[model samples]
Target: MSGKPKLYYFYGRGSMESIRWLLAAAGVEFEEEILETREQYEELLRDGALMFQQVPMVEIDGMKLSQTKAILQYIAAKYNLYGKDLKERALIDMYVGGTTDLMEIIMSYPFIQPEQKEGHLNTILLKAKNRYFPVYEKILRDHGEKYLVGNRFTWADVQLLEAILMVEEKCADILTNFPLLKVFQTRISDIPRIKAFLQPGSQRKPVPDEKYVQTVRTVLQMY
Candidate 1:
């Protein structure tokens, strides 16, 4: 309905990166609208214009979609990123769900108090190291695939990379323990379209803000 598909979100990656990456990988032409402030966000939330009480809204092909996973899946389906078959789809779902778990922990950092933030972040990292990271590590190690689910690239790889980069950016040595997983990260990140989406002049921030950097520092135990 609109002149071109448009993605709406804050400046940071937040929950929008996967969708943005998907669009780029699929070579979809789209416009991006960045909501500049909390007040503006609150207004949108209060006005009931948002189907869900959140950002990362996407308008495309005469439909507006909310919820990150739903949007990712829709884009994946449209672009054939969900994997090649039912079995691959199941595997992708498993990784996507796990990545969502990891995201929940990282997303909590901004709301954490400054004094307690470091400890909270460290706890979340430990949670990842114990609960989340190894699952994917084993997948990459055992499956021996450059991508996550199938022989080809998929949305699962996109989701997994977004999650892994959450930790890798902060702790330079975190991925050292999981060599295959590290390679997987590089392989997906190197995808030409996703690579371009992450280039310096891209609309997204090149790095997380200081608050999130504090979380990364805590996860890496650098502070």
Candidate 2:
């Protein structure tokens, strides 16, 4: 109980996961305000002066902040998690920028029609994956190491892992064909901090006992 700030997180378990994972990796302490119902969320919206209009808002000493990447930037800056050199920090920013595009695609999948699934949704992912894989491979190849950017873990590493996991979880078929992508995913997961974070309870909520994700898998299987 170090009296760290409180973070108000919503239930979707999307972009918020990256912020949570980065905090965990930094060993930061924060209270979680999980709003489970619309009534609760409405209450938050009305009764609070600085409350977030969206989920995944973090409050440091009662000051509210929103936007997942901005929260990561603030935490990374405060916790000294960015990097030592300017160029390295720039690289981390580059990776985070790339990850934002990946997140957009993931969020768009649910809106895609059945007929458009393979053509519209999967096609974008396939292209994005192909484009990003070599960049990651070059990083791993050039650094002669794991972890993106620097000697220590940064937000870039977390963002990269989250992007890779989203693809695997949502569209493993697209990933499996790319051996380098699979290897990159495996390599990132092997990081000790990341490996621990990927364990069962690390998810924002308890995943259903059954394979709820199977529905998405089945739909993808149809293509």
Q: What C-alpha lDDT do the candidate models reach, one value each?
A: 0.75, 0.67
Best by TM-score: 1
Model 1: CA > 4 A from native = 1-3, 37-48, 206-223
lDDT of 1 by residue, 1-223 (tens): 4567798776666677767767877878778776765566667677665796766789876777888888888888888988888998888888899898887777666656789988987887787788888888988778776777777888888778777877766566777677788778777778888788778876555555775555444432444
**Would you estimate the TM-scores of all the predictions?**
0.84, 0.77
Clashes counted in candidate 2 amount to 0
TM-score of model 1 vs. true structure: 0.84
Per-residue accuracy of model 2 over 12-68 as CA lDDT, tens digit each: 455566777787777775677755455666676786633446666777754678777
The 10-residue segment of model 2 with minimum total lDDT is 207-216
Clashing pairs in 1: none
